[model samples]
Target: MYLTFITMIMTLVGTASSASFSAPNKDLMTCTIAVGWMGVALGALSFVALLQLRVYGYINTFIWNRKPTGVYFIAPIIYIISMSILYAILSFVLPLNGGFVYNNITNTCVAQNVIYYIGLTFMIIQTVVLCLLLFKARTIDSCFWEFRKMLLVASVGILFGIIVLAIQHVHFGDDKVAVKGILVIIFTLLPQQVYFYTILGPPVYHLLRHREYYLHEFAAIVEEKGLAHIYELAGGCPLGEISDLSDSGKPYRTTAVNRLSNDSNFSGNEPAPEIGAPLPRNSNPRQSGPLLSYYKSLWNRASRNN
Candidate 1:
């Protein structure tokens, strides 16, 4: 549940911080594609970090399964590679430049294809992962499955767009005027400009709002309060399982107790994380100290040495 909340917050941050600013020399289409890829990288990094937490049995939520879903890691990898190739092919096969090599404000159709495909690929990967999530819910309790509801909303939008692209690829043979126009506008506008902007940067967004480190807070809270007790109170779900903390759209379902969170355990016995089992740092520089300050520190050392 915490991770899911963090995910949504990260999406919001990505949308808020991402600028439409482009390089003067680089095509605007490519620029947009590059920005989209950055978001994908950010999302992938976040997924990997959370997956690591699961592997280490750090989470106390209940929605997660007993075993770390290898799917969590596998899906993202396949999606990124497949999407990259798809984007590359689309860029060359059907130019988004109004069917001309250089008719639109951006570069040739191929460049636009490259840019649009990156976003499209992200959309597809998100959808597939979400669908897998939805299916996994049937095996768990309703309370543990609700967090995925918001995930469903985000995934649905992406899936809808992918369906459109698939049909366009078939009917118009992947390069028809109506299909390309409809696709570029749909992907770049609806989900790209709005939906994705809303869902891609939840962790950063949460930090921006709280002005405190969330990951640290989660660990600290678990340490101070004791995750084992929390787990027992949370219904003794199991090690490495998260409970669903999603709402049911009912008045009775809005409370935190009703929300099902995934239940993964912290240290079970012998020793606790507080005695000092801090999760190793993952090196996300954005939230870290200033790079300029680091450079300054290094330069001072160099001057002294000279």
Candidate 2:
């Protein structure tokens, strides 16, 4: 599947790089437009594979979650749309007549109103969303956003190039490809940054921030004592979904802390009750060990329920 996708991209690139054959720019333009729309055709299959990976990487199959688990997840949909639009432009819009350089019209106009305009718009949107996701990722876990870190940097460069391209479009009206010098620098120099943030960044962020308990400096601090007291203090807000841990959901956080009330007494054949119990600091130095053990036992039972 991956090979096929690459081949398709190559075919388009072949048509796009008009320095070719007995074929004229018009023929190359016609083929390129036709080839690019193949992305939309393959979008369903690609979407399924990506969705499965996201689901499997998250909680188990027994669990149900929303369509998108995190903000960074937005990148894929944007990519799909961008590819679709970009290919459509290349395949149908044919060659651009001209382009701009800063405020100067470097190339003369070729196509009427270039479809690349739409493709460029999609690319800009994708780049912006990716940057925002990377910037906000530091809140969950510093390491969680690592995958996007490079992408964010790359997106900056890509966006700058796009801006120059857009400036060309403004000046020259998309007749020819503009920013050749800059695109040459960017497309090769920062490909990894582009690919990494788009593909590898989100999952890395999720894995890094997967568990709140794993992050809290207090987790290590309390481990020296015992597990129950730790849970007693911290078990309320689940480590399950860090995305759900935002400050905006004050009620949910409150409910999480107070969830024991929902399952106060063990009811089903599920298991025995082992809920975490809160304790007063000064009042329970002696009880800490046993209490920690109790909470740990409860956590084990709850894990079975989930």
Candidate 3:
């Protein structure tokens, strides 16, 4: 958690510094320093999440008796170690142009090529391993699906940026590629920042503010509903059939409603209740299940406490 907080602070600092020093006539050393800081901060932030995920899995296994597959435990450790080694090697090998006078264009280009290749290699490896680990974990637990999707989107954006940088490096002689690559990177950074905040910010905030409450609520729901039903509640499509019904310009009825109406238990020609209407008093608890019940209880508790 301290690492996460530090990462956020570093990211903000780096972004601000980059924006301030991004002018065409800006000192190259300053720009490089800002970029390097941002890179290290983001890299650390990325691995911190992996460590957290591993910790979460350990908790699930020991406390909840919900053991994730072995791969979930193993893959993250491998990725963290591999990435750490790669970063260490790159740090030693890559040259930082710290406002120094380069003797020639050749030396500058060589440094640029080394940094570009090292960064690109790290990105490729990180993307592949992280995606695989997340995907595998998602298969083991549906709750991770959102995390998997968000990470995949971010990875694709990064892969695109890396490709642009690669092109820039390969055509080092062409000023056009360098300009295009810089532009692409700037364009990509905005969306990636938005993605990070939009997808991750709320959950992190909630965890920080209501950590105990959130955990208790989750445990209650999982206990009450059973894991399979909880999974469905998390991932199920409540309005999935709405699109099909919309094409025919008919009011959408849920499968549950149709089944109830057809049964001897409910023999009314009366119109089905509105989509968002509350269920009847005698409605099956199994339909809505514990997830909904947990939310209601949580809301009531909050209201009372306030």
Give the candidate number with the greatest lDDT. 3
* Candidate 1 regions with alpha-carbon error over 4 angstroms: 1-22, 27-36, 39-122, 142-148, 159-306
* Model 2 TM-score (2 dp): 0.36
Worst 10 residues of 1 by lDDT: 244-253
* Residue range with the least summed lDDT across 10 consecutive positions in model 2: 100-109
Stretches off by above 4 angstroms in model 2 are 1-31, 34-79, 82-112, 142-151, 159-189, 193-306
Give the Cα lDDT of each candidate. 0.37, 0.36, 0.42
TM-score of 1: 0.34
Q: On a 0 to 100 scale, what is the lDDT of residue 245 in model 3? A: 14
Say which prediction, candidate 1 or candidate 2, comes out ahead on lDDT: 1
Query: How would you encode candidate 3's per-residue C-alpha lDDT over 1-306 as one tens digit per residue?
Result: 334445555544444443233334444454444444343325433534443354344234323444444775566556565654555445444555422122232222122455545655665665565555455445444332345545555565556555645544465453353454455446445434554564455445555566335434443433343343323222223211111111121222222223223333222233433323333332444234333343345456776886
lDDT of 3 at 159: 61
lDDT score for residue 42 of model 2 = 31
Global lDDT of model 3: 0.42
lDDT of 2 by residue, 1-306 (tens): 243335335433432332122234334343343323432223312322332233222222112222333543555456544555544545454543422111123321122334445445554554554455444333322213322344454455565555545544453333434444334334423433444344445444543553332223222233343333223332232322222222213333332223333554333333322434432233444334332333444545655765
Q: Which pairs clash in model 3? A: none
What is the RMSD, in Å, between candidate 1 and the native fold over all Cα? 16.1
Candidate 3 backbone overlaps, count: 0
TM-score of 3: 0.46
